[model samples]
Target: MAVCKGCGVTLQSTDPNAIGYTPKEGSEYCQRCFRLMHYDDLTVSMRTGIDPDQIIEQIAKMDALIIYVVDLFDFEAGMIPGLARKLPDKDILMVCAKRDILPDTLNHEKVARFVFARLKELNIKVKGLVLTSKLHSEGIDDVKEAIRMLGHGRPVVVMGRANSGKSTLLNNLFGQNILTSSRFPGTTLEMNQIVVDGITYIDTPGIEIENSLLMDVNESDLKTILPYKTIKPQIFQLHGDQSFAVAGLARLDLMECDHAACVWYLSDKLQVHRSKVQAADELWRKHYGELFSPVPLEENFRVSTIRKNLSKMDIVIDGLGWASVSGQISTISVRAPKSVNVTFRKAML
Candidate 1:
């Protein structure tokens, strides 16, 4: 039941060289991940818990067929270039899982287009994209038919990011919830194959990478990260040197305001720093644990000093929120984990 952090494989007490291995009272990792961590250059040969590359290599050596499932909500981050790049010879059919939770405004065609664009960025060409919600059984037959037609009698592989609902979809395909479902992240931690009639499908573990970003954070943090329900957008007007903290996960230092020049778009539940930008530092020094509290500033989440000029470039705090500048401003700096991606964008506000 405990999942491996290194490769997301399930842990078992039986085989030390098996997919799941828990060392004596210490830690657990899939056998392949253990070898990757401990033994350099030694690779998984013929067992489960194989690394993504090994999985890709296996897929590459296959007889040309697959269905790549991607979490539509986090498609950009869940991309697997190793698999996509290696399986070019095989027919690649992309399946977008979790259609039920998408905001109503999200156009299905638009999502497919976005997936295509992201795949292109990864240098992986695809034949088509299918969107589905296995929970509701939508688009199931279409995906089945697509795979059946493209696979041309070869075994079909089902691979995707962890929690993308692959197991859920598979269970639905079998008309029951045979797979275990949980509210936590990274639940499915291994590649499993289930056969229906003649087609055999392979399920791979969700791999982590630079793009895992918000995916790598703890579930509690994600409660502050992914906005599940509607959040009323908050906007704050401030004076020079205004500072604000976002659920204690991030901070914003606002300088000379031409327009609003504020950090907007945080979780509706998080408190925005409303005091003068000048008092921002004093506020943190005085009340980080007291008033300006989000998910308390943990040692693990801490980052070095953040200092950068406002410089009119839009600052985006990944997961939580972002800010846009209007008028003259100096530098604004923030410090958070290196995992959090801070990117600049044109002002959308």
Candidate 2:
């Protein structure tokens, strides 16, 4: 049986509704990959079926260098927890992708330091770290050099969360779009290998992020939610009580606070509506699908009350951007979809 050149699924002439179906013989790509490449259409949602633990187990048996790709914009959701414990013997190189989404004014050294600090906190050890951008060539050469120095005659395995730019990074390394890359998650259904510059590289299925808005929203809303360009931080001043509804997907309510500044780092297409704390609920109920557009299919929401005494911190909504809050003392409440993860961490500015 021959596997698809784009997505590593066994090709079959039968079963048009099933995965890996091809109408003709000797097709290079599966039906799903072919449509995605030609028409930008997704035939299946790869988020539900793939087993992440099984993927890790398969990687554990391989004797190759691991190149862990992560989305710099959605770093929290992109991370695969307990990776070091599972692949303890493997030498992992963390490649932070989509660096272009963040502002260029921020120092790259500071960003690297922030990534290292987070990795140390999570106990995830890496041989080295490289920040990359698909639109820029700043770190592409560094990635190649790192792979050459660290590969040591072993195949390089690329693995990361779904839609984290794994295939895009590989294409960048190859200087062409050899693999299937799309906005849809789970583009690579199985393991596919490619040889570039005398080095073997394997592309693996993207591990699904269970607690992310990316899984909850419709595919059409992705363009508005995911940042393709540098984000222009929208700063809001809060004195007593105010609430911000982030495109009906999530809401941030400042219950009580002294003079504070909340800087939002999100897609320019999204609308951030500010209202008094008392009127927030009414406003949401009145205009959730209209004025506040692009909400999840289900209206069920989970509210998390966070009290931050730190002078500076960030409230991160998985797959969505974060808001940096700075003040003496503040009590904030985040209301979002129950499945989406909401957490706080040190400000990454």
RMSD of each: 8.5, 1.2
Per-residue error (Å), model 1, residue 45: 25
* Stretches of candidate 1 exceeding 4 Å from the true structure: 1-50, 81-84, 209-244, 252-277, 284-335, 343-349
For residues 1-349, could you state the per-residue lDDT of candidate 1 as single tens digits? 7765444466777876655576644465555555545552233332122355665666677775667777655444456656554666667887887665555566777766656666776887666778888556888888877876787877776666555666666766667644443323444455555567777766555444343435445454555565554345565665566666765566766555544555465456667766675666677778765665554323244333333444545566544456555565555666555566565544433
For residues 1-349, what per-residue lDDT tens digits would candidate 2 score against the true structure? 9998887888999999988999989988888999999998998878666888888899999999999999999999977789878898788999999999999998889999999999998889999999999996658999998988999999999999999999999999999988999988888989889988799999999998888999899888988899989999999888778899998999999867678889999999999999988999999999898989899866789999978867898999998899999985468899999999998989999
Which candidate should be chosen as best, given TM-score against the real structure? Answer: 2
lDDT of each: 0.59, 0.90
CA shift of 324, model 2, Å: 0.7
Off by over 4 Å in 2: none
lDDT of 2 at 222: 86
Candidate 2, residue 196: how far the Cα is off, in Å: 1.8
